[model samples]
Target: MTLSEELLMAYDRQLRTDAETPSAIGIERLGPLRLVTFAGGRGFVTYQDLAGASARTISHWVAEALAFYRSDPAIARVEWKTRGHDHAPGLHGALLDNGFEPDETESIMIGPAHSLNVQVQLPPGVSLRRVSAERDIRAMSAMQDEVFGVDASDGNADAILRRVAREDGMELWVAEHEGAIVSAGRLEPVPDTDFAGIWGGATRAEWRGQGIYRALTAARARAALALGKTLIHSDSTEYSRPILERYGLRRVSTTTPYRWRR
Candidate 1:
């Protein structure tokens, strides 16, 4: 199958209609999809089998789902993660009609585990390793928030702590050069799936294209494969998109998140 076809099938089988695993907290059923409510009063929608839904069905689902989120006072913001190949008939129109403004459309990059798992030559005075220390985790999360342009969040740190507390098979990796963190990423080995997710990859502004991000990704990929994951996936921005492309990760689809704010 082509990348687009695989994308559609994946979303159908995994995201929209029959997502086997929901987010760790605050998920409610909205028809066939799960409406995810997370710590920051943020709502998310995901499903796996939306490829076959008719235009009218898609229309109704979108309207009803927005209404459900809109009625909830605690939901200060919401994102409907729409995949590029998903047969979400009239979804764009419906979302625009409902005041959900589109955010950046990111590349849905996916590929074999080995392709991105190559060794990286870290600069002298640089080190890479898995981190579990509470202080290190907080600092790393704070750096991520800064890079992503969000305020430093205790909730984010708390969640990392919770993950560490549970020993949830989630690994945080960071690269340090000259006694400071230069790049970092997370490896999430999804339980019972051949896939692992590479998320929250961030690099300091001065360290942008010196193979640090790729090295961080390679480290995560190596770890994932060691744990028997065959596939890797990420929602990539333009910066990292080119790097992943060079590593044989195809842009299987696009995910444009539409956010609704109170």
Candidate 2:
């Protein structure tokens, strides 16, 4: 197998379970699925594979998993993360039949952390730093929500605060211009593994085309390397995929999130 293929295999083997939900408040098992509950009334579903189940059996598992999440009144939203390389026959039909709407597909990019650690010139009057203060985090979250075209909500910021309190090796980084946050992303170093994920990367519309986001990614990559993480991974949208690709992160596969709202 090629190096990218080998790395993708390692990623599937090492980072597919609770490692994907390090901040989950609760987890339950249903066949090969891991039903996870996080802080903010969010439910998530993921697994390494289907264990060679038939299409009919997989459909049943889907219905059962949806029922499991639906039973919880606290769950406002559930996302089933499906990988492109998995043998999930009838999975798409099953999800749509059960009211789960598929979101945009993202590239699963992975590569050496050091490759992303190159220097990037920030725009004039812009600076990057690690944020921890509640006020700072809230600002960063709000900016990200706006950049992503989502309604401003405190739920994400609150959940992030809880994770911060746990000290789980998750780092929040941001780029600021004259005291206003223009870009932000997170670095989560997975425990007992060589991988750290770069997630929630967002930059304001006006900030696009500049190197601010790339610089922010590099800062996070450097931080991950400092924490002994050799591999960097991300489920990157079209906006960020090319940037990561430019940094030598190979797109090993695709991941699409199917969502159900309560």
Candidate 3:
């Protein structure tokens, strides 16, 4: 197999379990699906594959999964994560029929952490560092929410603060210009794995194309390397995909989230 193919297989085997469900309040299994409940009334569905089930079987699974989430009064929203390389026939139609709406697809980028640990020059007056204080974490979360086009909500900040309190090997990094956050991302080093995920990468519109995000990514990469993580991965949007590609990460697969709201 090619290097990219090998890496993709490793991702499926190593990273697609309860390891992906950190901070989850509870989890239940249905066939290959992991029904995860988070602290903020959010549910999530993901799996390694469909277990070679037929199209009709997958459709039935989808319906059953949605029903499971709907039965929970506390679950206000659920996201079903689909991978492009899976044999999940009829999943799209089934999810839509069950009131799920698809979000934009993202490239699953993977590569050695060292490939991204290069020196990146930030724009003038910009610096990068790790943040854990509640005020700094809230500011970072707010900026990310704005960049991602979501309303600035206290729930997000609260959720992050709770994770910070847990100290579960998750690190938040940000680039600041004159004491204001310009770009931010988080490093999650999976327990007992060779991989660390760089997630929630965002830069302000005004700061785009100035390398702030790249620097933040590199800083997180260096942190991962220090922790003995050999591999780095991310689900990257178009704006950030090219940057990661240039840093030697391969687009191993694609993932799209189907969201259902109550």
Runs with alpha carbons beyond 4 Å of true place in candidate 1: 2-22, 54-56
**Candidate 2 lDDT trough over 10 residues, lowest sum:** 13-22
Q: Candidate 1 clashing pairs?
A: 11-48, 12-48, 12-49, 15-47, 15-48, 16-47, 16-48, 17-48, 17-49
Model 2 spans > 4 angstroms off: none
Q: Give the TM-scores of the predictions, in the order they appear.
A: 0.89, 0.99, 0.99
- Measured on C-alpha atoms, candidate 3 has an lDDT of 0.93
Q: What is candidate 1's lDDT per residue for 117-236, written digit by digit as tens?
A: 788887778789899999999989998999988999998898778777877788999999876888889987877666788989999898887788988899999999899988888889
Per-model lDDT? 0.81, 0.94, 0.93
For residue 147, give model 2's deviation from the true position in Å: 0.8
In angstroms, the error of model 1 at 121 is 1.2
254, model 2: CA deviation in Å? 0.2
